[model samples]
Target: MSKPIFERDPSDPERQKINPALKLLLELGPLLVFFFGNARGEWIAERLPALAGIGGPIFIATALFMVATVIALAVSWALTRSLPIMPLVSGIVVLVFGALTLWLQDELFIKLKPTIINSIFGLLLLGGLLIFRVSLLRYVFDSAFNIDEEGWNKLTVRWGAYFLVMAVVNEIIWRNFSTDFWVAFKVWGFTPLAIAFTMAQMPLISRHSLDEEPAE
Candidate 1:
């Protein structure tokens, strides 16, 4: 029988250790909550008066997003006994930006969250590869894939460039688009882009598969 995700041995580096559906929920639950909260913040505030201080719909959503992120991290810690680095970093970003958005009553901070996070990821990946000669992608995805050194290097370069593009795209959308459209795009558009990008990497991944003969 497959080991339950929470019970998987830390020493094992395998994909789908956790149920994929549950993993997706834990990773994305907060974002889904944030989107819902933004769409219904006033309704929620009216029903629960304590949240009136949260200001606008987006602000209320940001506050809830912070709470949800904290919960997700807590649950991850409880289950894994160790924090996942990328999620931890992203969670920290959300809290800091979420707090600023609430304290300043300016939505710009929350709006810039994706841009900042994506840019940091992009720079870290590219800088690690180009300047430090390190492939940070391995740390993030080692469990899911095993690649040759050359493959890792190429994949790292590709992902780094993609992340930079995503960051610029976020900036453009938030700066010029409607808030509703931006929020929806964050949920729908960017996610599809990321999924597509990941899928697109399969050719390179399969070529470098440790378990299979390297493609000629």
Candidate 2:
């Protein structure tokens, strides 16, 4: 029997058909906006004094950051129809936390938002494997590369732990560091760390790769 049209299967022919450059753009655009909004907060506030009452650069940045996130998600939906799973999760948290930060006029909420989201993701991914006997990693990565169930479990576990580490790191940085420093870490530090960690898993990925198989 054929798979449902909207269901994502690791072996789907169409899953492998995304435009690599566009995919990268979709992934990176909102992050760029976040960094830009944070970095340019003062300039933006100067041009629009109303933003000054928003508390500080970080607050202004958070507001614009939310706007940028919405735009990014909209673009993703326009391009892909379905939302990208990971970013969709993160975007929802952004909207929620960003709103709280704005409404409460507390930067702490915004600062802690990443920590909460990462912790939730870490626990969810890890708990999914433990309880359901399946790794959710396949949904995000199945299109790019195929892996055996064991490989999926291992990747999921590693990513889960990685998310926890990110949560801890975000907590440490935001609680103790300057807003500029945290924003820099948020934009620059995390992505490279994730990329490096992914590279470290190359052996496991190669071992289980179904790259050459015909779509099921």
Candidate 3:
């Protein structure tokens, strides 16, 4: 029996590879849209009129974010015939929380979405390591990285910790800051932090890389 359309066989030679730039755009585009929607919610609402029923700026942003996320996932599936696990998981949370935010007219649900998603990811990654002695990160990044088991273990630990930290940070910011500030941080602050953390791991990745040529 053939695998499901959404399940990618990474080892298959025929599997289409997405360009790195395009992949980054697909992942980041929705967040950008969310930020823009929030900043220009009045403008957008006035022009579209239908979206004004969604409520204020934050609510408008959440609705746009949800739509953009669905589009991103659909594009990924259409191009590759598979959804990336992390984004797919995030998208599900966005849809659920976004719906709750819109229907209940409460922005709190949308604010908590990141906290919930990050906590889930943190627990899954750490729990997999603790209980199964497996680095689930390996499965996620295997296509992009080739490293020893030790590297994967260390990477998993770092990422799990980082995710938990992000969850805490999200909680703090949303609780204390204005909605606009929180949205800005989510788009600008968290993204740079994640990028910096990934860059910081390059040395560890290099040390454990299986692709290194054997020294004579």
Index of the highest-TM-score prediction:
3
Q: Is candidate 2 or candidate 3 better by TM-score?
A: 3
TM-score, candidate 1, is 0.86
Per residue, candidate 1 scores C-alpha lDDT tens digits across 12-131 of: 564224444665678789989999989999999999899987798899899999999999988876766656666788899999999999999999999999999899888989999999
The digit string of per-residue lDDT tens for model 3 on 7-114 reads 454455666667767878998999999999999999999999999988999999999999999999999889877777778889999999999999999999999999
Whole-model lDDT, model 2:
0.81
Worst 10 residues of 1 by lDDT: 2-11
Q: How many clashes (backbone N, Cα, C below 3 Å) per candidate?
A: 0, 0, 0
lDDT of candidate model 3 versus the reference: 0.90
Taking all chains together, each candidate's TM-score versus the true structure is 0.86, 0.86, 0.92
lDDT of 1 at 58: 94
Instruction: Output the number of the lDDT-best candidate.
Output: 3
